[model samples]
Target: MTSIRRRLLLSLFGLWITVWAAVALTTLDRSGHEVGELMDAQMAQLARVLREISLTDPQPAAKATPQALSAVGHPYESKLSYQRWLGDRLVASFGVAPVTPLAATIGFSDQEFGGARWRVFGLPGNAPDEVLFVAQSDTIREELIHFLTIQALKPILWSLPVSVLLMWLAVGEGLRPLYRLARSIGRRSAERLEPIDGDGVPAEIRPLTAALNDLMERLDQALAAERRFAADASHELRTPFAIIRTYAQIARRSGDPAERQAALDNLIRGVDRASRLISQLLILARLQGEPRATGRGVASLVRAAARVVADWQTDAQAAALTLTAAAAEGEPGVVAVPAAALGILIGNLVENGLKYTPPGGWVQVAIGSGRGSVALRVTDSGPGIPAADRERVFDRFYRPPGQAQPGSGLGLAIVRRICDLYGLRIEIRDGADGVGLSVLVIFPEPSGSPKAHPP
Candidate 1:
């Protein structure tokens, strides 16, 4: 493939050659015609003046002297020659025209004298009996044009070398910034995510460097997240795996049915915990690139919470805890949400409430609105989170102080992902009347114009 610079140079070169060719041909045609006409007129004029030599006056050679030819032309430049018919014999000087051997002696016409061609005039005014002829060479026309072409082209041939040098310098100057950017990247370690120094960089290249820096930052985060995930997975998997191993050993040692049954129950509990942790991890993974709009009724914040709490109530009944939801009236029946995400949010909050609250204490899921945002509040009769740890609660695998619950710690991470996706805000605070923890998820209302489509 040809480079752009070479292609541009070739195009310019072709144009210059074409222009010079046209100029050469046009100059040759115009100058040749003008010079030829001027030469022909001179010859005619010379012939007329010579016919005034009166041979009938006895000594005509007196007026044909070299000084007498001074009125026609100089001796060196623009050659002029003459011929006279001295009694049917021809005379001549150096001329380019070949002999016109059969020309008639009319009043004014072309003729041949000696060995050269001539323009002649047979006159009856001054001498009724004589004819005169004169001629000049045509080589001066070609000589003048050839000299002009050489002078015009001399500078052009020399300027091409200078032009190429200038072009080389300009291209290097233009590409200097690109070379600097490459050098900056080349000097960096692969593990680093530091920003590029944008000072002295051109505005045209700033956007490219900024984009590369952004990509590096994201790569750093992704690597960190992967390490955290591996550690968290190992810790979570170790618990259930140990319980299964212990239960298997016990079942093998015990021959009685009752001991085997006890071992089976331990195995089941271990499996349940493992399953929940796996499900929560799966949720976090899915939420890495989760799609947001689930427009179903199940995606409603209050409804989803009510269902999750209903399930939690049945589970907590065996542990002497009460689970319930307190939905506000006159609120929109079903808000648009991502259902998988909303379920994760509602499930985590309600479970935390049930776990921390004492038996006979109530877990309330409330929905209300104020200040252009709708609120989903989960309040309970449990020890509330500390102000310092409240900010950190949404982190993956994080637990509040004095917490004893067996969890993978990914619950609030899932919840926070949902909250971020739905534009909802999460807060952990003392409940109304200062008894327990309150986690409220505030959602912004749709723009008062919900568009619909046929299913």
Candidate 2:
């Protein structure tokens, strides 16, 4: 149930206590040695002093006068002691325990004799005194060692709880940045992918924040691309889809042979239009970062559009639609595009223009180059897209509002996708004094002028 901080504090506290305990034990041993030496020295000094005092006076008797001896060695109030001896008998004393084993030899402070414990030391007297002895106990040394051990250990034990509190505060402070990041993230919605500000984040957490921001940017781009695709597809497919439905209903209800055949023809054309729109949708997918469209080699815009235009003329004439091609004489005939892709690019433009133009309306295709670039244009005399809807018309499956054209709406999307693949640019605008829409494609003239493959 103990937390990490408490556990660490306890561990440290226990280690410190163990260490100090060892130190205290070692101190006790040393204290015994020093106290023993001090007791021996004091006892020796007292015994020698007693002997000198006993023998220094003028005395003919070998033994000190009993009164004189007693005066010198009565019980001293402090730990000090002195005793006098005859040849083999105790004569006078100071602080003498009743059962002290005081003898001729120097004695230890822990000796026992009779019925009591004593500390005693004996020394030889001068000319007249036979021997003098001194002794004291170690009670004071034991009390002092116990007091020091208690004082030194009290502070170390009491400091652990306070140390644990400080440690918890530091840990929480260190994690404050993470808390801030979490709160910031919690405030965001699923649709919000804006990058978070990473300034002032700790070095250890910077990479994490940066990674999340990168993910948000990618999600934003993906969502935008998806929205664009949906809007574009909805716009492009609406026209033909309506045409197919209307003609189908007409065919279903009509009993007149000629009217039914006309409705069937319109329905067939609607199917073709739907097919073209679907193909353009596929191209748009390719243009949106697909790997298959990568590295489409360059070709001549003149030759590429010529082939597409020729095929479109066969269809345009069959539909009683007018088609034309215009190009500069002996000028550069090359455009930067892949050969196969070039056909789809021009064919879609020409076909769309022909389909939307009235029976007599003309579709003009042109190719020309100067100033390090080639320009390809498809111009038509059909009802042109309004200036306001020019950009929107380029969206996949998009047909301008109120547009009555019977073609797939993806013609411009196909044109835009191809342009992107070849590093070309395209725009739709009023043609020849704002007559009908003219779709323009400008291709960059590459250095070393890439050779055009024969189509």
Candidate 3:
């Protein structure tokens, strides 16, 4: 695996090396040019000095055979040579093969003599027929250039280790914050969902830290909700089971047939209550577990409400209550919800209303669409919820005091959860004459293709 720190270090080191290489190349080039210019100047100066010496000589030597100068001299002097031409005769020569007119051109020139390349500077002699030339072998200048280049690069080559060490240290120091953040996360307990501290964190990584904190907050809430649900379920189910056991014992001990029958009936009622509570508990759990609605297709609110009324018609009649459903005329009565979700929502509301309302009372389920909103409203001619108790009614297993109703108190809670999942808005108010409860669920505009249907 490739490490981030290693990559960063390598990138920085490569950049530094590249920059140094460029500078070194430029320095070497400049040093070669300057050294060449100095050597050329020395050759020209030697030529001038030879011309002056030949002009001042009063007894010029007679022309003789060419002779090689001594090999022992200053390290550079052995490479130097001079030639003088007087009227087409070699008057003097040193350290090199005799050659007439060492260079055909006048100023500075390069020529091969004695199997070696030389830099030659030719000067006009004081006498019109005399010519002077001073030449140095190319090897001498190359040696000097090589020496100077090595000297120039010594500092950079020697400092490389120190520079690399410093770079490594700097990179490590720069990354300390990230290391601390990683350690902080690694040290956390699994159950600890608290947000991480943002203090001392680098600005570049703030977004990452913020996202982590947001996720932790959400997880904390979910865990808390789960814990609360478990506690409530255990507490609520305990009571019904205890009553069922008590009634069963009473039936076993009773001697009169009618008394025993009454005890059995109570036991059955207790069992039924426990069964309903368990069923509601499972439904609530499923509703919480399922993913939230995406409003993928339009569901007919009128159809869902009418279906709930039809299914509950017998129950309504058994309770001696009139339950009815209607849709507004000339409206699609569509909403952005699934058909099953709409049915569950309406069914819970109508069931709650039927269970609470007195005999001869009415429960109305209506679907209306207007003003860019679709609403499913359930009105019951029952004792209305007090204004203070409206919000608390949505809590799990919370029942109002002084209400002698056989209920698990989960119907409205389930409806509220469904509304929250689908982004629906619910409102509670007094029914007609302020004597009953009115529950209204408002949904956003219909999504996808909506099909109109009658109630």
Candidate 4:
């Protein structure tokens, strides 16, 4: 597993080392340049002093000691060399004097002598042909530059451990709040869905905590919906179960064959009602957990409505209701919903319309496409719902007052859930001529059609 702290520390250390290395190299270069300039100035100053002394004494001692060339008790004293000449002949020599004649050129110049490279300064003596040369070995100058560079870089080396410790402390302090938040969340139980306290949270971490709190809130809502579903399912199932048992008992105890047959028929109806209620409840439960549709599945609204109308035509005929399906001027576009979900949505709307309409009433399923949207309309010539109870009918198990038709009250609720998942718009209003109910559903643009035909 990767660690944030470790990666942060590694990145910081890498940057720190890179900067230090650059500084060290710059310091070394600057130190070498400055020291070389200073050493060259010293060589010029030594030549001037030697010139004055040679002019002061026209005649000098034949034997010259090595110490005469430079100051005693100095670390680089032995590396110094000098040559004095008069009338094109060597007069005195000291230290590692070269055997060959020194260059006649004046000022400082690099010359190879005494089997070593030297920085030499040439000066004219008092006599026309007289000259003085003072020189230092290249190795001595390099050693001096190396020593000064080390001294200049010593502070950075000494401060490294202290700086690293401070950096580690700062990084740890910066991440302490995140660690605390993790611990706080880890301590929470599944049953405890209270919002996390954001009072002391850092501004950088506020977004993370806010998102987590939002997720917890959604989870809490889902759990509540599940609980309500459980309670409502049990309550609604109890009535049908009791009714079925009573009918079965009556059928068993009745003496007349006609009475027995009636009880048996009622028991069969009760079982069917119970089964339909269970199926609708299961569908609602499945849809409750889906927050949104994938929008990849596509289905034709016209086709789905036609299929639903066809499936219920027999029932409509038996009830003396006029059931018909039609499409508008254009072929209805595909909708971004699964074929099964489309079937359920249209099936529920058609069933609900037929259930409420009276004998000889007409129920219509219309499909149309316009303005990049698909509209599915289910209208019935039944007694219309009041404006006050229109929205309430979409709530599960909700039924308007004085309704004689038997229903689980979940059809419209299931329709609403599907519309919400697929981002469809639903509107309820009076039917044509203001006689009954009309539910208009607007579906968004089509994503695409499937390669295979929709089921």
- Top-TM-score structure, candidate number: 4
Off by over 4 Å in 2: 1-197, 200-219, 231-263, 289-296, 329-332, 383-389, 396-402, 420-422, 428-437, 452-455
TM-score of each: 0.60, 0.49, 0.69, 0.82
Residue-level error in angstroms, candidate 3, position 46: 6.3
TM-score of 3: 0.69
Every candidate's CA RMSD? 9.3, 13.5, 5.8, 4.1
Give the range where candidate 2 is weakest over 10 consecutive residues by summed lDDT: 60-69
For 1-455, candidate 2 gives per-residue lDDT tens digits of 85655675567666766876897677677766776677667767777677668766534344432232245554434444456665565566645334233654755446555444557777776744466677665555566666666666568557757765776677667778888998898888768778888889999999999998987787777678878887767776787799899999999999999999999999998898789677777776666754334345557777777788778778899878778888988654665467777888888888778877888778999888878878888999888877788888777556777767555566677677667666778877788987876988888776675454533
lDDT of 3 by residue, 1-455 (tens): 98988999999889989988997888788878998899999888888888888767845688755564555757666678888888777788877745666788778999888789988888888888888888899999888888888888889889899999999999898889889988888876658877889999999888989998887787777778788899999999999999999989999999989999999999999998999899899989888766567575677787788789999999999999999988867667777888887888899999999999999999999888778888888999999899999999999999989889888889989999999888889999999788799999998886455555522
Specify the poorest-scoring 10-residue window by lDDT in model 1. Answer: 93-102
lDDT of 1 by residue, 43-136 (tens): 6666666565433444444223222344566653324455454444443222332233123555545544445444444433344444455544
Which of 1 and 3 is the better model by TM-score? 3
Question: Ranking under TM-score, best-scoring first?
Answer: 4, 3, 1, 2
lDDT of each: 0.68, 0.72, 0.86, 0.87
Identify the runs in model 1 with alpha carbons over 4 angstroms from their true place: 1-165, 186-190, 285-330, 333-337, 358-361, 383-389, 401-404, 420-423, 446-455
Ranking by lDDT: 4, 3, 2, 1
lDDT of 2: 0.72
